[model samples]
Target chain A: MNTFMGYERPNGDIGIRNHLLIIPTVICSNQVCSRIMQLVPGTVAIPHQHGCSQIGADKERTFEVLAGTGKNPNVGGVIVISLGCEVVDPYALADDIRKTGKPVEVFDIQSVGGSVKAIKHGTELARRMLEELERQPKVPIPLSRLKVAVKCGGSDATSGLASNPALGAAADALIAAGGTVVIGETTEIIGAEHVLAQRCATPDTAERLYHIVGRFEREVERMGADMRGGNPSPGNIEGGLSTIEEKSLGCISKCGKAPIKGVIEYAERLPEGGLYFMDSPGNDIECVSGMAAGGVHIVCFTTGRGTPTGAAVVPVIKITGNKRMYDRMEDNMDVDVSAMLEGAMSLESAGERIWQEILEIADGKWTKSETLGHQEFSINRIGPSL
Target chain B: MKQQIADGVDALIMDNRDHVATVLREIMSGDTVRYRDDHGIREITAIDLIPFGHKIAIEVLDTGDDVCKYGEIIGRACFAILVGQHVHVHNIEGIRGRGDRAGKAGT
Candidate 1:
């Protein structure tokens, strides 16, 4: 239990996987990145629709998220693809990830000749990086080296009782082992923000928690609608939730009972350890993408109703507490804690089960998401697409 | 502690001393239900028809008194409430300094 095998980076970051990633800094370079991924068997690429015409925080958020994703411990090396001039600076992003001591290569479509030349160049660089990554061997690392993001999507009544709390217990275990655990979805904290604030380790942390909640609320209101009517999602309502507050209260359980160490902005690199909160939207894909982009090595996602969502790089471990849903979506699920309701399993036992699954996943086992090829990626957008 | 019940179809945290429990089955006026306090489950008859997961006022609470759930006040009753009536947004108002969601708890 003390150590799980992982690939160690030169910067001292331990990676669960030694994946060589091809990151496209702009939408224009997505095809090139994807082509590179297709050519290189072990390489992964995330094609997002942002990085152009975005200004201020939105543009900065893109750069930070993309850089963080590349720097995630799961990636042993990275190759960044860019269009030479975009809102996000590819060199700066490369520099940011290079600090992790991993091999980083940057190529621009305009700088490297043209589209045909860029694709060829990007593929060659990706192939070299993949070969270099393949040379690195995994070593046994302490459990404390792990950092996990806890999430829930497609929730139902059973989510609170089963999967969320079960994941929370696993989160608590990770924190106890001196590892870092982060929980996000600021919008889901709406009606329940106060309760979480009280658990903050410091007054400032508590204030920041509320500040993020307020900002999301005000921003949503500016769009001329309330969050309650829409926050639950049509599926959530049909599953039995009534209001945003109702949904928020249940969503908070995935974090477990750890002290809220701090609140961070969306896509920001997580401060090393303990439980931190990432300010993010509740939209499942965006939420998972933000966590993946923020350097989370893996994500423990809970659901009552199911979703087949995954990330382009980070492995998403799907956990469900609903027995029926688990049975129906067995192909999509990784772990099931539904036995707790039947008195066949203790909550702690269920948590330990999930923790074991996480360890196995971190050790390079493919999750149901990965096996099924569910690499769904999307960036939360702001401003107009110009 | 007198126990308040979370009514309606959604799950809820009723008392700060008691864990928020989901409503598995619906109840009607005069139907007897059991609620747990610090000691154990106490049986009480519904004063009015109550849906699943919606809260029922357990003790006399004034406006702004923190409504407890998951063993903490999730929000405050927006208005006064009798001992055995439904507690929800219609009656429960948010205390709102830094509490987690308003009514739902134990998630």
Candidate 2:
């Protein structure tokens, strides 16, 4: 069994990278979080327009996503800053993260006097947390302890042909090694759900799979519209896809042929082993963010077109099978499996290549997105902002 | 080998269901073709104007007939479909189950 060297967290999770995360409880505190992250070297803060004016499930979703992100194994420690009057409580958020056994500190701008005062207090706590995190050491961890999330964006014809299938092979390889793999984008799976259901371990799991698809359809129906008009984007059509089912059939290929053990909600903790499904929207950034918050240490994103998106903590490995697009966006991409289409490479060969890349990345080799400083972050909002 | 059509676009082969060949390209009228009793791809000589990503109705399909593509039934044809034509929003519709609630309404 292969293994990689990584930092062993006090909470029993192995982390590929030790990241110091700065979180804001409200959109109002984003500036402060950004300021602190800038002032303190090696600290990363997520800036987003959420955490306020949300009601019911929407507000809870924000809170859960925030806490889950902070608690992700990749994060060594966290510094949570709040506006004091937001819907999400800063102290509670800090407590939730502290459960991970990492260093956690919280401060409210209103309670700490103001921006200047809050920054001052935040700087002190951030410095302390960073110092403590720096004290942690790396340990040898099995590859099976690692979880990778598979995603795709800006898809094209070559996606299903070269990139996604290659990703599927890689996903199967990881699962064979006893490592966990997760695939999401429920909207993209619309046409191929039945095929996936057939691969479910049992009848109940199959039923559960159908339930997820039904839920999304009903939700769309509630919006008083039909998906017949749109699901495959203009880009998908231009790239040669005609319907949602057509696009979905190709999209579902990334999951490979592993038995789906369970289906989980967005940003929820994944199952122990094998392939799992996370319920996430098709928006690239939001889906990736949800996976990160769900505790995935790395993301394996396959694209036929291209996107430059990275998470604050986890490393994102961008793979593509479109030779032209790969060359066009070499800076943003890491693995190019286009040779599979050209017949120079086999699917298993491509999968082996990706698995090697995963090992190197886990050992601290920065992905193209990370080196380019593409730390794009966004949370999917459930309802309209008021 | 078990071959299933993920859709009308990609053809997938596994070990379980090897009886039928899935559709790799869309078929149209005036096109000649041969496939399993389920479905087959025909060459478009006259090009009867089929949508690129949509499925083509290869043979007579009953209401409960499993719509085959990539060697597997992606869905059940909601209505009867004619042979050698297009199959998509016009004929096939999805049936979702309960657990698919993580993303937005549509793909």
Candidate 3:
């Protein structure tokens, strides 16, 4: 079938999961939000460390990510909680989300008297929002409205050889079906960006692609450190990735052979269908979080060393190429393409298997990460605290 | 197709022009490591112990030469590397995105 079950949003976007997301606008509101989530059923809360004492780009990122997560079509309603005196404006955040035409309610901890009172007030708000969301009927969403992010973490050599190529094939299939595909982790694009540049659909995209890469490299250089200090991270080196280029070459394969239509900044909303690249950190949680905030409905993650990471607002499907790691971390992994390395399975067959899994997930099948409750969230911050 | 394990094509050369092959299994010194690429299945002897998933040099590389994998330059060789030797962080250095070595290795 070319369509999946989803809820129609008033903003004209289709959401596969009708999540009532509890957003903490600042660190002081996290405990209250968490309490409300526990007190009310069918609620998810995102607890973050920033939103206080942050200045300039750092503070702006926290606001943009929080607001974008609230605007994500996957979320049907939102409850924004604040600490009253943080740098990020809670009411402003609520206003940003309201622009999406979704139901959003905002309140601050200081005005509500304290944590206990705040939790009580937030729980009541959540329960009512969730009830309203439950009344929304599920409708069919075409593949054209679906956007999936391709990410890789804890990569080993086999990632480049097996699972990534398999995922690349699946990515191509998704785009062929009129779906949108996004690939991020600009940190992984260091050496082989030339290959991506050559595949850009326009000169503008190629320039933007080069601009982001060059900017990241200059920043890393300004810090007086090498990308090697953290990249091809110890786990990656142990798993057989020797250099940034080798790791990046493997990393890029998961996005397939589609021409990049655009290169967007972190947390920026995506354009309509075809392939796009988001300039995001290579850190797993940060990259996935950025993509989720950018309106991706699902994340197709490839790992070689294995990770249990998921996203707070979107479903993350874990695909691996290491047979031993998959067997060891079977509970965390959903698809295993290691047979391609053994020559037991063709690349196309392995890719088809992943493609089928993506379809099933879009139809409401829970991913291993979702089933295991791996809702990991992180925001990429530039600049520093005041 | 099912003869992979028994046939001893235990390693892979992702591209035919790559200078190294990734061993699918641990290889003891002097063991014949078999691999397949565009040229089909080929064999080389490991002169040093290579761990599983690590690289085994398929070509001789001198210091300052590019270490090729996936048919692209992964790093620059800091030390001499012989055919069948282990190629890793100890012998190869990443040449991009560093400020300490700025103005060197452009492109």
* Top candidate (TM-score): 3
Question: Which one wins by DockQ: 1 or 3?
Answer: 3
Ranking by DockQ: 3, 2, 1
Worst-scoring 10-residue span by lDDT in model 3 chain B: B1-10
Order the numbered candidates by lDDT, best leading.
Answer: 3, 1, 2
Give the alpha carbon lDDT tens digit for every residue of A1-386 in model 1. 68888888888888887778888889999998888788778788889888888888778778877888888888888988899888888899999999888889988999799888988888788777777778788789998878899999988766766678789889999999999999999888887888899999999999999888888776765655434446677676555554566667778888989899999877888888899999888888888888887788899999888898888778899999778778999999999997765546777888999999998998779999999878787887766666
TM-score of chain B of 3: 0.85
Between candidates 1 and 2, which one is better according to DockQ?
A: 2
Error of 3 at A204 (Å): 1.7
- Cα-based lDDT for every prediction: 0.77, 0.76, 0.89
TM-score of chain B of 1: 0.63
Residue A286 lDDT, candidate 2, scale 0-100: 91
Candidate achieving the largest DockQ = 3
Per-prediction interface RMSD in Å:
7.9, 7.4, 3.0
Model 3 error, position B54 (Å):
1.0
Q: lDDT (0-100) at residue A153 of candidate 3?
A: 91
* DockQ, cand. 1: 0.11
